[model samples]
Target: MDVLRYVAFATDASGGNPAGVVLDASGADEAAMLAVAAEVGYSETAFAVPRPDGGLDVRYFSPLAEVSFCGHATIATAVAHAREHGPGARDFHTRAGLVRVGTSVGADGVITAELVSVPPRSVPPAPDDLPELLAALRWSADELDPALPPRIAYAGAWHPVIAASTRQRLAALDYDMAALGDLMRRRDWTTVDLVWRESETVFHARNPFPPGGVVEDPATGAAAGAFGGYLRELGLVALPAELTIHQGDDMGRPSVLTVGIPADPAEGISVRGAAVPIPD
Candidate 1:
Protein backbone atom coordinates (compact mmCIF):
# COMPACT_ATOMS: atom_id res chain seq x y z
CA MET A 1 0.00 0.00 0.00
CA ASP A 2 1.30 3.45 -0.85
CA VAL A 3 0.97 5.70 2.19
CA LEU A 4 1.27 9.49 1.91
CA ARG A 5 2.36 11.67 4.82
CA TYR A 6 1.09 15.23 5.15
CA VAL A 7 0.81 17.88 7.83
CA ALA A 8 -2.53 19.67 8.17
CA PHE A 9 -3.26 23.22 9.33
CA ALA A 10 0.31 24.37 8.73
CA THR A 11 2.01 26.38 6.01
CA ASP A 12 5.34 24.64 6.76
CA ALA A 13 6.15 20.98 7.29
CA SER A 14 7.47 21.69 10.78
CA GLY A 15 4.07 22.77 12.09
CA GLY A 16 0.58 21.23 12.32
CA ASN A 17 -0.38 17.58 12.87
CA PRO A 18 0.99 14.83 10.67
CA ALA A 19 -1.35 12.20 9.23
CA GLY A 20 -1.14 9.15 7.01
CA VAL A 21 -3.18 9.13 3.82
CA VAL A 22 -3.97 6.17 1.60
CA LEU A 23 -5.39 7.44 -1.68
CA ASP A 24 -6.67 4.03 -2.74
CA ALA A 25 -7.58 1.42 -0.15
CA SER A 26 -10.40 -0.23 -2.05
CA GLY A 27 -8.98 -3.75 -1.74
CA ALA A 28 -7.93 -3.47 1.91
CA ASP A 29 -10.04 -5.07 4.60
CA GLU A 30 -10.49 -3.88 8.17
CA ALA A 31 -7.53 -5.86 9.39
CA ALA A 32 -5.40 -4.70 6.49
CA MET A 33 -6.32 -1.10 7.12
CA LEU A 34 -5.55 -1.46 10.80
CA ALA A 35 -2.20 -3.04 10.04
CA VAL A 36 -1.29 -0.30 7.59
CA ALA A 37 -2.32 2.38 10.06
CA ALA A 38 -0.22 0.81 12.80
CA GLU A 39 2.75 0.60 10.47
CA VAL A 40 2.36 4.27 9.54
CA GLY A 41 2.15 5.15 13.28
CA TYR A 42 0.69 8.59 13.04
CA SER A 43 -2.04 9.86 15.38
CA GLU A 44 -4.52 8.87 12.64
CA THR A 45 -4.44 7.33 9.15
CA ALA A 46 -7.17 7.97 6.60
CA PHE A 47 -8.15 5.32 4.06
CA ALA A 48 -10.14 6.33 1.00
CA VAL A 49 -11.94 4.00 -1.36
CA PRO A 50 -13.61 5.25 -4.52
CA ARG A 51 -17.26 4.36 -4.61
CA PRO A 52 -19.38 3.48 -7.65
CA ASP A 53 -20.88 6.89 -7.16
CA GLY A 54 -18.63 9.89 -7.40
CA GLY A 55 -18.26 10.19 -3.62
CA LEU A 56 -15.48 8.60 -1.63
CA ASP A 57 -15.80 6.21 1.28
CA VAL A 58 -13.43 7.12 4.09
CA ARG A 59 -12.31 5.46 7.28
CA TYR A 60 -9.98 6.63 10.04
CA PHE A 61 -7.72 4.46 12.17
CA SER A 62 -5.30 5.17 14.96
CA PRO A 63 -2.39 3.00 15.96
CA LEU A 64 -4.43 1.37 18.72
CA ALA A 65 -7.97 1.46 17.29
CA GLU A 66 -10.33 2.86 14.68
CA VAL A 67 -12.12 6.14 15.22
CA SER A 68 -15.37 7.29 13.66
CA PHE A 69 -13.87 10.53 12.45
CA CYS A 70 -10.57 12.44 12.49
CA GLY A 71 -10.24 16.08 11.46
CA HIS A 72 -6.54 16.45 10.71
CA ALA A 73 -6.46 13.19 8.78
CA THR A 74 -9.49 14.25 6.75
CA ILE A 75 -7.83 17.54 5.91
CA ALA A 76 -4.65 15.81 4.86
CA THR A 77 -6.53 13.36 2.67
CA ALA A 78 -8.57 16.08 0.94
CA VAL A 79 -5.49 18.13 0.22
CA ALA A 80 -3.66 15.09 -1.06
CA HIS A 81 -6.54 14.19 -3.37
CA ALA A 82 -6.75 17.74 -4.65
CA ARG A 83 -3.04 17.87 -5.43
CA GLU A 84 -3.37 14.73 -7.54
CA HIS A 85 -6.83 15.16 -9.10
CA GLY A 86 -7.05 18.92 -9.39
CA PRO A 87 -8.52 21.19 -6.73
CA GLY A 88 -12.29 21.05 -6.37
CA ALA A 89 -15.11 19.90 -4.13
CA ARG A 90 -15.38 16.36 -2.80
CA ASP A 91 -17.83 14.49 -0.64
CA PHE A 92 -16.65 11.88 1.84
CA HIS A 93 -18.98 9.29 3.27
CA THR A 94 -17.61 8.58 6.72
CA ARG A 95 -18.93 6.54 9.63
CA ALA A 96 -19.93 9.76 11.32
CA GLY A 97 -21.87 11.15 8.33
CA LEU A 98 -21.49 12.78 4.96
CA VAL A 99 -18.74 15.40 5.10
CA ARG A 100 -18.19 17.86 2.26
CA VAL A 101 -14.73 19.20 1.55
CA GLY A 102 -13.69 22.01 -0.79
CA THR A 103 -10.10 22.40 -1.90
CA SER A 104 -8.22 25.20 -3.67
CA VAL A 105 -4.65 26.12 -4.45
CA GLY A 106 -3.31 29.53 -3.58
CA ALA A 107 -1.12 31.69 -5.82
CA ASP A 108 1.85 30.49 -3.79
CA GLY A 109 0.94 26.90 -4.77
CA VAL A 110 -0.23 26.15 -1.24
CA ILE A 111 -3.30 23.89 -0.98
CA THR A 112 -6.07 24.77 1.45
CA ALA A 113 -9.05 22.59 2.33
CA GLU A 114 -12.29 23.47 4.04
CA LEU A 115 -14.50 20.79 5.53
CA VAL A 116 -18.07 21.17 6.63
CA SER A 117 -18.79 18.87 9.52
CA VAL A 118 -22.00 17.04 10.43
CA PRO A 119 -24.53 19.01 12.42
CA PRO A 120 -23.02 19.62 15.83
CA ARG A 121 -24.61 18.95 19.19
CA SER A 122 -23.65 19.64 22.79
CA VAL A 123 -24.75 17.96 26.01
CA PRO A 124 -23.99 18.94 29.56
CA PRO A 125 -21.44 16.77 31.31
CA ALA A 126 -22.74 14.43 33.94
CA PRO A 127 -22.29 15.96 37.38
CA ASP A 128 -20.73 12.78 38.77
CA ASP A 129 -18.11 12.74 36.03
CA LEU A 130 -16.79 16.20 36.80
CA PRO A 131 -14.62 15.19 39.72
CA GLU A 132 -13.18 12.22 37.90
CA LEU A 133 -12.51 14.34 34.82
CA LEU A 134 -10.86 17.07 36.85
CA ALA A 135 -8.88 14.56 38.83
CA ALA A 136 -7.56 12.87 35.71
CA LEU A 137 -6.60 16.27 34.26
CA ARG A 138 -5.03 17.30 37.61
CA TRP A 139 -7.12 20.45 37.35
CA SER A 140 -9.20 21.90 40.12
CA ALA A 141 -12.64 23.35 39.59
CA ASP A 142 -11.24 26.75 40.45
CA GLU A 143 -8.99 26.60 37.39
CA LEU A 144 -11.94 26.15 35.02
CA ASP A 145 -13.44 29.10 33.20
CA PRO A 146 -16.91 29.67 34.59
CA ALA A 147 -18.13 31.42 31.47
CA LEU A 148 -17.31 28.56 29.14
CA PRO A 149 -18.65 25.87 31.48
CA PRO A 150 -18.21 22.15 30.75
CA ARG A 151 -19.90 19.99 28.17
CA ILE A 152 -19.46 17.14 25.77
CA ALA A 153 -19.49 18.60 22.26
CA TYR A 154 -20.00 16.56 19.12
CA ALA A 155 -19.43 17.43 15.49
CA GLY A 156 -18.07 14.33 13.83
CA ALA A 157 -16.96 12.91 17.22
CA TRP A 158 -17.51 13.51 20.89
CA HIS A 159 -15.07 15.63 22.93
CA PRO A 160 -15.23 16.96 26.43
CA VAL A 161 -14.80 20.71 26.16
CA ILE A 162 -13.00 22.17 29.14
CA ALA A 163 -11.92 25.78 29.25
CA ALA A 164 -9.13 27.12 31.46
CA SER A 165 -9.53 30.40 33.26
CA THR A 166 -6.09 31.55 32.18
CA ARG A 167 -3.54 30.82 29.49
CA GLN A 168 -1.10 29.73 32.21
CA ARG A 169 -3.54 27.15 33.44
CA LEU A 170 -4.06 25.76 29.95
CA ALA A 171 -0.33 25.60 29.26
CA ALA A 172 0.53 23.51 32.32
CA LEU A 173 -0.65 20.13 31.09
CA ASP A 174 0.29 17.10 33.13
CA TYR A 175 -2.12 14.22 33.49
CA ASP A 176 -2.13 10.56 34.44
CA MET A 177 -2.22 8.76 31.14
CA ALA A 178 -3.75 5.55 32.37
CA ALA A 179 -6.38 7.28 34.44
CA LEU A 180 -7.40 9.65 31.65
CA GLY A 181 -7.34 6.91 29.06
CA ASP A 182 -9.59 4.70 31.14
CA LEU A 183 -11.97 7.57 31.78
CA MET A 184 -12.12 8.46 28.09
CA ARG A 185 -12.80 4.87 27.11
CA ARG A 186 -15.63 4.62 29.60
CA ARG A 187 -17.09 7.90 28.37
CA ASP A 188 -16.50 7.05 24.69
CA TRP A 189 -14.67 10.31 24.16
CA THR A 190 -12.21 10.76 21.27
CA THR A 191 -10.25 13.57 22.91
CA VAL A 192 -10.45 16.13 25.64
CA ASP A 193 -10.51 19.65 24.19
CA LEU A 194 -8.64 21.90 26.59
CA VAL A 195 -8.91 25.55 25.69
CA TRP A 196 -8.21 29.12 26.78
CA ARG A 197 -9.95 32.03 25.11
CA GLU A 198 -7.55 34.82 24.21
CA SER A 199 -10.30 37.10 22.95
CA GLU A 200 -13.83 36.99 21.56
CA THR A 201 -12.50 35.67 18.27
CA VAL A 202 -9.19 34.03 19.16
CA PHE A 203 -8.59 30.87 21.23
CA HIS A 204 -5.76 28.53 22.13
CA ALA A 205 -6.35 24.82 22.47
CA ARG A 206 -4.73 21.50 23.33
CA ASN A 207 -6.29 18.10 22.72
CA PRO A 208 -5.45 15.10 24.90
CA PHE A 209 -6.08 12.04 22.77
CA PRO A 210 -5.17 9.24 25.14
CA PRO A 211 -7.93 7.05 23.73
CA GLY A 212 -6.06 7.07 20.43
CA GLY A 213 -2.78 6.40 22.29
CA VAL A 214 -1.66 9.94 21.56
CA VAL A 215 -0.64 12.37 24.28
CA GLU A 216 -1.73 15.43 22.31
CA ASP A 217 -3.05 16.34 18.88
CA PRO A 218 -1.48 19.41 17.26
CA ALA A 219 -4.64 20.49 15.45
CA THR A 220 -8.10 18.95 15.71
CA GLY A 221 -10.52 20.25 13.05
CA ALA A 222 -13.46 18.19 14.33
CA ALA A 223 -13.13 19.68 17.78
CA ALA A 224 -12.92 23.14 16.25
CA GLY A 225 -16.23 22.52 14.46
CA ALA A 226 -17.84 21.27 17.64
CA PHE A 227 -16.45 24.24 19.55
CA GLY A 228 -18.01 26.63 17.08
CA GLY A 229 -21.33 24.90 17.63
CA TYR A 230 -20.87 24.96 21.38
CA LEU A 231 -20.35 28.70 21.33
CA ARG A 232 -23.37 29.25 19.10
CA GLU A 233 -25.60 26.93 21.11
CA LEU A 234 -24.69 28.72 24.33
CA GLY A 235 -25.06 32.13 22.71
CA LEU A 236 -21.47 32.87 23.55
CA VAL A 237 -20.69 34.25 20.10
CA ALA A 238 -22.55 36.35 17.60
CA LEU A 239 -23.99 34.65 14.54
CA PRO A 240 -22.01 34.43 11.32
CA ALA A 241 -18.83 34.69 13.33
CA GLU A 242 -15.35 33.72 12.32
CA LEU A 243 -13.12 32.32 15.04
CA THR A 244 -9.41 31.55 14.95
CA ILE A 245 -7.90 28.68 16.88
CA HIS A 246 -4.19 28.48 17.72
CA GLN A 247 -2.99 25.02 18.67
CA GLY A 248 0.15 22.88 18.99
CA ASP A 249 2.36 25.84 19.89
CA ASP A 250 2.85 24.44 23.36
CA MET A 251 4.18 21.28 21.75
CA GLY A 252 6.45 23.38 19.47
CA ARG A 253 4.35 22.48 16.37
CA PRO A 254 2.27 25.58 15.80
CA SER A 255 -1.04 25.04 13.93
CA VAL A 256 -3.78 27.43 12.92
CA LEU A 257 -7.44 26.50 12.23
CA THR A 258 -10.16 28.87 11.10
CA VAL A 259 -13.80 28.11 11.90
CA GLY A 260 -16.83 29.73 10.26
CA ILE A 261 -20.13 29.67 12.06
CA PRO A 262 -23.27 30.39 10.05
CA ALA A 263 -26.32 32.21 11.27
CA ASP A 264 -28.46 29.10 11.17
CA PRO A 265 -27.68 27.02 14.24
CA ALA A 266 -28.62 23.79 12.46
CA GLU A 267 -26.08 24.29 9.71
CA GLY A 268 -22.77 22.51 9.87
CA ILE A 269 -19.65 24.44 10.90
CA SER A 270 -16.82 24.99 8.43
CA VAL A 271 -13.20 24.39 9.42
CA ARG A 272 -10.48 25.53 7.05
CA GLY A 273 -6.70 25.07 7.00
CA ALA A 274 -3.66 24.53 4.83
CA ALA A 275 -1.90 21.19 4.35
CA VAL A 276 1.62 20.44 3.11
CA PRO A 277 3.23 17.20 2.06
CA ILE A 278 5.83 15.91 4.51
CA PRO A 279 9.12 15.08 2.87
CA ASP A 280 10.46 11.65 3.54
Candidate 2:
Protein backbone atom coordinates (compact mmCIF):
# COMPACT_ATOMS: atom_id res chain seq x y z
CA MET A 1 0.00 0.00 0.00
CA ASP A 2 2.86 2.33 -0.83
CA VAL A 3 2.28 5.33 -3.11
CA LEU A 4 5.01 6.47 -5.50
CA ARG A 5 4.78 9.45 -7.80
CA TYR A 6 6.85 9.43 -11.00
CA VAL A 7 6.92 11.45 -14.17
CA ALA A 8 7.26 9.69 -17.51
CA PHE A 9 8.87 10.68 -20.84
CA ALA A 10 11.30 13.28 -19.52
CA THR A 11 14.56 12.98 -17.64
CA ASP A 12 14.21 16.26 -15.78
CA ALA A 13 12.10 16.37 -12.62
CA SER A 14 10.21 19.49 -13.69
CA GLY A 15 9.62 18.37 -17.26
CA GLY A 16 7.56 15.22 -17.96
CA ASN A 17 4.01 14.31 -16.93
CA PRO A 18 3.51 13.08 -13.36
CA ALA A 19 1.45 10.01 -12.43
CA GLY A 20 0.74 8.39 -9.05
CA VAL A 21 1.44 4.68 -8.56
CA VAL A 22 0.64 2.10 -5.92
CA LEU A 23 2.81 -1.01 -6.31
CA ASP A 24 1.12 -3.31 -3.80
CA ALA A 25 -2.50 -2.30 -3.77
CA SER A 26 -4.01 -5.71 -2.98
CA GLY A 27 -6.13 -4.38 -0.12
CA ALA A 28 -7.55 -1.35 -1.94
CA ASP A 29 -10.97 -1.60 -3.59
CA GLU A 30 -12.47 0.56 -6.30
CA ALA A 31 -13.60 3.19 -3.84
CA ALA A 32 -10.23 3.21 -2.13
CA MET A 33 -8.46 3.58 -5.46
CA LEU A 34 -10.75 6.43 -6.44
CA ALA A 35 -10.12 8.21 -3.15
CA VAL A 36 -6.36 7.74 -3.44
CA ALA A 37 -6.38 9.03 -7.01
CA ALA A 38 -8.39 12.10 -6.02
CA GLU A 39 -6.02 12.85 -3.18
CA VAL A 40 -3.03 12.39 -5.45
CA GLY A 41 -4.62 14.95 -7.81
CA TYR A 42 -2.48 14.02 -10.78
CA SER A 43 -3.94 13.32 -14.20
CA GLU A 44 -3.91 9.56 -13.49
CA THR A 45 -2.93 7.05 -10.79
CA ALA A 46 -1.99 3.39 -11.25
CA PHE A 47 -2.87 0.57 -8.88
CA ALA A 48 -1.35 -2.88 -9.21
CA VAL A 49 -1.94 -6.05 -7.24
CA PRO A 50 0.60 -8.81 -7.66
CA ARG A 51 -1.04 -11.91 -9.05
CA PRO A 52 -0.33 -15.58 -8.25
CA ASP A 53 0.78 -16.15 -11.82
CA GLY A 54 3.61 -13.64 -11.35
CA GLY A 55 1.85 -10.97 -13.39
CA LEU A 56 -0.22 -8.04 -12.11
CA ASP A 57 -3.80 -6.89 -11.84
CA VAL A 58 -3.60 -3.25 -12.82
CA ARG A 59 -6.17 -0.48 -12.71
CA TYR A 60 -6.05 3.24 -13.45
CA PHE A 61 -8.00 6.10 -11.94
CA SER A 62 -8.20 9.79 -12.57
CA PRO A 63 -9.53 12.38 -10.17
CA LEU A 64 -13.00 11.84 -11.63
CA ALA A 65 -13.34 8.17 -12.75
CA GLU A 66 -11.59 4.91 -13.41
CA VAL A 67 -9.92 4.52 -16.81
CA SER A 68 -9.37 1.38 -18.85
CA PHE A 69 -5.63 2.00 -19.21
CA CYS A 70 -3.06 4.75 -18.99
CA GLY A 71 0.39 4.80 -20.63
CA HIS A 72 2.17 7.30 -18.43
CA ALA A 73 1.00 5.57 -15.28
CA THR A 74 2.03 2.21 -16.70
CA ILE A 75 5.47 3.55 -17.44
CA ALA A 76 5.80 4.95 -13.95
CA THR A 77 4.69 1.70 -12.37
CA ALA A 78 7.20 -0.31 -14.39
CA VAL A 79 10.06 1.90 -13.31
CA ALA A 80 8.95 1.79 -9.71
CA HIS A 81 8.68 -2.00 -9.86
CA ALA A 82 12.16 -2.19 -11.30
CA ARG A 83 13.52 0.04 -8.59
CA GLU A 84 12.24 -2.33 -5.90
CA HIS A 85 12.43 -5.75 -7.67
CA GLY A 86 14.98 -5.03 -10.37
CA PRO A 87 14.49 -4.45 -14.10
CA GLY A 88 12.38 -6.97 -16.02
CA ALA A 89 9.15 -7.71 -17.86
CA ARG A 90 5.80 -7.19 -16.15
CA ASP A 91 2.35 -8.12 -17.43
CA PHE A 92 -0.74 -6.19 -16.47
CA HIS A 93 -4.33 -7.35 -16.73
CA THR A 94 -5.96 -4.01 -17.36
CA ARG A 95 -9.62 -3.14 -17.92
CA ALA A 96 -8.89 -2.71 -21.61
CA GLY A 97 -7.06 -6.04 -21.93
CA LEU A 98 -3.55 -7.43 -21.38
CA VAL A 99 -0.66 -4.97 -21.26
CA ARG A 100 3.04 -5.91 -21.29
CA VAL A 101 5.59 -3.55 -19.83
CA GLY A 102 9.37 -3.88 -19.77
CA THR A 103 11.95 -1.82 -17.94
CA SER A 104 15.73 -1.28 -18.07
CA VAL A 105 18.09 0.82 -15.99
CA GLY A 106 21.12 2.47 -17.48
CA ALA A 107 24.60 2.45 -15.96
CA ASP A 108 23.91 5.99 -14.87
CA GLY A 109 20.91 4.68 -12.87
CA VAL A 110 18.28 6.22 -15.11
CA ILE A 111 15.23 4.01 -15.67
CA THR A 112 13.29 3.73 -18.90
CA ALA A 113 10.14 1.74 -19.54
CA GLU A 114 8.14 0.78 -22.62
CA LEU A 115 4.64 -0.65 -22.80
CA VAL A 116 3.13 -2.79 -25.56
CA SER A 117 -0.58 -2.19 -25.62
CA VAL A 118 -3.48 -4.37 -26.72
CA PRO A 119 -4.46 -4.84 -30.39
CA PRO A 120 -5.05 -1.41 -31.85
CA ARG A 121 -8.00 -0.48 -34.05
CA SER A 122 -9.39 2.58 -35.82
CA VAL A 123 -12.59 3.70 -37.51
CA PRO A 124 -13.82 6.91 -39.07
CA PRO A 125 -15.52 9.28 -36.68
CA ALA A 126 -19.26 9.00 -36.55
CA PRO A 127 -20.92 11.56 -38.82
CA ASP A 128 -23.20 12.61 -36.00
CA ASP A 129 -20.39 12.89 -33.49
CA LEU A 130 -18.16 15.08 -35.64
CA PRO A 131 -20.40 18.13 -35.26
CA GLU A 132 -20.51 17.72 -31.50
CA LEU A 133 -16.72 17.40 -31.37
CA LEU A 134 -16.18 20.45 -33.53
CA ALA A 135 -18.55 22.45 -31.41
CA ALA A 136 -16.85 21.36 -28.22
CA LEU A 137 -13.46 22.29 -29.63
CA ARG A 138 -14.78 25.48 -31.22
CA TRP A 139 -13.25 24.47 -34.50
CA SER A 140 -14.83 24.98 -37.90
CA ALA A 141 -15.09 22.18 -40.44
CA ASP A 142 -12.91 24.21 -42.78
CA GLU A 143 -10.14 24.51 -40.19
CA LEU A 144 -9.50 20.76 -40.22
CA ASP A 145 -6.44 19.53 -42.12
CA PRO A 146 -8.69 17.48 -44.48
CA ALA A 147 -5.77 15.14 -45.07
CA LEU A 148 -6.27 13.78 -41.60
CA PRO A 149 -10.01 13.63 -41.18
CA PRO A 150 -11.59 12.94 -37.82
CA ARG A 151 -11.53 9.38 -36.48
CA ILE A 152 -11.71 7.35 -33.30
CA ALA A 153 -8.68 5.16 -32.70
CA TYR A 154 -7.93 2.74 -29.92
CA ALA A 155 -4.89 1.05 -28.45
CA GLY A 156 -5.92 0.60 -24.84
CA ALA A 157 -8.56 3.37 -24.91
CA TRP A 158 -10.57 5.44 -27.37
CA HIS A 159 -9.48 8.91 -28.44
CA PRO A 160 -10.99 11.17 -31.09
CA VAL A 161 -8.35 12.32 -33.56
CA ILE A 162 -8.65 15.93 -34.70
CA ALA A 163 -5.91 17.48 -36.79
CA ALA A 164 -5.42 21.23 -36.70
CA SER A 165 -4.62 23.39 -39.71
CA THR A 166 -1.33 24.67 -38.26
CA ARG A 167 0.97 24.51 -35.25
CA GLN A 168 -0.38 27.82 -34.05
CA ARG A 169 -3.89 26.45 -34.12
CA LEU A 170 -2.85 23.44 -32.08
CA ALA A 171 -1.08 25.53 -29.42
CA ALA A 172 -3.99 27.81 -28.58
CA LEU A 173 -6.12 25.52 -26.40
CA ASP A 174 -8.71 27.67 -24.62
CA TYR A 175 -12.03 25.84 -24.30
CA ASP A 176 -14.96 25.20 -21.98
CA MET A 177 -13.69 22.57 -19.54
CA ALA A 178 -17.10 21.78 -18.06
CA ALA A 179 -18.83 21.56 -21.43
CA LEU A 180 -16.07 19.42 -22.91
CA GLY A 181 -16.03 17.22 -19.83
CA ASP A 182 -19.75 16.55 -20.30
CA LEU A 183 -19.20 15.71 -23.96
CA MET A 184 -16.35 13.30 -23.20
CA ARG A 185 -18.43 11.60 -20.54
CA ARG A 186 -21.26 11.17 -23.03
CA ARG A 187 -18.91 9.63 -25.62
CA ASP A 188 -16.71 7.74 -23.12
CA TRP A 189 -13.59 9.19 -24.66
CA THR A 190 -10.25 9.26 -22.82
CA THR A 191 -8.86 12.35 -24.52
CA VAL A 192 -9.13 14.50 -27.65
CA ASP A 193 -6.01 14.23 -29.83
CA LEU A 194 -5.48 17.74 -31.10
CA VAL A 195 -2.58 17.67 -33.55
CA TRP A 196 -0.63 19.54 -36.20
CA ARG A 197 1.42 17.81 -38.87
CA GLU A 198 5.02 18.92 -38.91
CA SER A 199 5.94 16.26 -41.47
CA GLU A 200 4.89 12.81 -42.57
CA THR A 201 6.76 11.35 -39.62
CA VAL A 202 6.66 14.25 -37.18
CA PHE A 203 3.76 15.90 -35.36
CA HIS A 204 2.92 18.21 -32.48
CA ALA A 205 -0.01 17.52 -30.21
CA ARG A 206 -2.06 18.67 -27.25
CA ASN A 207 -4.42 16.37 -25.39
CA PRO A 208 -7.48 17.82 -23.66
CA PHE A 209 -8.49 15.51 -20.80
CA PRO A 210 -11.25 17.44 -19.09
CA PRO A 211 -13.16 14.39 -17.94
CA GLY A 212 -10.13 13.29 -15.92
CA GLY A 213 -10.56 16.49 -13.91
CA VAL A 214 -7.51 17.98 -15.60
CA VAL A 215 -7.64 20.77 -18.14
CA GLU A 216 -4.94 19.08 -20.25
CA ASP A 217 -2.46 16.25 -20.12
CA PRO A 218 1.25 16.99 -20.37
CA ALA A 219 2.04 13.68 -22.03
CA THR A 220 -0.53 11.30 -23.47
CA GLY A 221 0.80 7.92 -24.67
CA ALA A 222 -2.65 6.42 -25.31
CA ALA A 223 -3.59 9.24 -27.66
CA ALA A 224 -0.22 9.02 -29.39
CA GLY A 225 -0.59 5.30 -30.10
CA ALA A 226 -4.16 5.69 -31.33
CA PHE A 227 -3.02 8.54 -33.50
CA GLY A 228 -0.51 6.25 -35.17
CA GLY A 229 -3.39 3.96 -36.00
CA TYR A 230 -5.46 6.87 -37.23
CA LEU A 231 -2.76 7.99 -39.65
CA ARG A 232 -2.25 4.48 -40.95
CA GLU A 233 -5.97 3.82 -41.35
CA LEU A 234 -6.60 7.05 -43.20
CA GLY A 235 -3.64 6.40 -45.51
CA LEU A 236 -2.25 9.73 -44.39
CA VAL A 237 1.13 8.16 -43.66
CA ALA A 238 3.01 5.17 -44.99
CA LEU A 239 3.46 1.87 -43.21
CA PRO A 240 6.24 1.00 -40.69
CA ALA A 241 6.54 4.67 -39.98
CA GLU A 242 8.39 5.96 -36.94
CA LEU A 243 6.43 8.99 -35.83
CA THR A 244 7.43 11.62 -33.29
CA ILE A 245 4.78 13.39 -31.27
CA HIS A 246 5.88 16.47 -29.27
CA GLN A 247 3.46 17.49 -26.56
CA GLY A 248 3.10 19.47 -23.30
CA ASP A 249 5.12 22.51 -24.34
CA ASP A 250 2.17 24.81 -23.87
CA MET A 251 1.73 23.47 -20.35
CA GLY A 252 5.52 23.70 -19.79
CA ARG A 253 6.10 20.00 -19.05
CA PRO A 254 7.31 19.36 -22.67
CA SER A 255 7.15 15.63 -23.31
CA VAL A 256 8.06 13.57 -26.37
CA LEU A 257 6.52 10.25 -27.44
CA THR A 258 7.85 8.05 -30.23
CA VAL A 259 5.55 5.56 -31.92
CA GLY A 260 6.01 2.84 -34.51
CA ILE A 261 3.29 1.48 -36.76
CA PRO A 262 3.58 -1.79 -38.60
CA ALA A 263 2.27 -2.71 -42.04
CA ASP A 264 -0.30 -5.15 -40.76
CA PRO A 265 -3.34 -3.81 -38.97
CA ALA A 266 -3.49 -6.68 -36.49
CA GLU A 267 -0.18 -5.94 -34.81
CA GLY A 268 0.03 -3.93 -31.60
CA ILE A 269 1.74 -0.59 -32.13
CA SER A 270 4.91 0.31 -30.15
CA VAL A 271 5.14 3.48 -28.07
CA ARG A 272 8.43 4.50 -26.47
CA GLY A 273 9.48 7.25 -24.09
CA ALA A 274 11.95 7.83 -21.27
CA ALA A 275 10.82 7.93 -17.64
CA VAL A 276 12.67 9.27 -14.60
CA PRO A 277 11.69 9.37 -10.97
CA ILE A 278 10.10 12.39 -9.34
CA PRO A 279 12.22 12.87 -6.24
CA ASP A 280 10.60 12.34 -2.84
lDDT of each: 0.95, 0.87
> Worst 10-residue stretch by lDDT in candidate 2?
229-238
Each model's RMSD to truth, in Å? Answer: 0.7, 1.2
Model 1: per-residue Cα lDDT at residue 77: 97
How does candidate 1 score on lDDT?
A: 0.95
**Alpha-carbon deviation at 262 in model 2, angstroms:** 1.8
Count of backbone clashes, every candidate in sequence: 0, 0
TM-score of 1: 0.99
Cα-based lDDT at residue 98, candidate 1: 98
Q: For candidate 2, lDDT tens digit of each residue in 35-82?
A: 999999999999999999988999999998999989888888888888
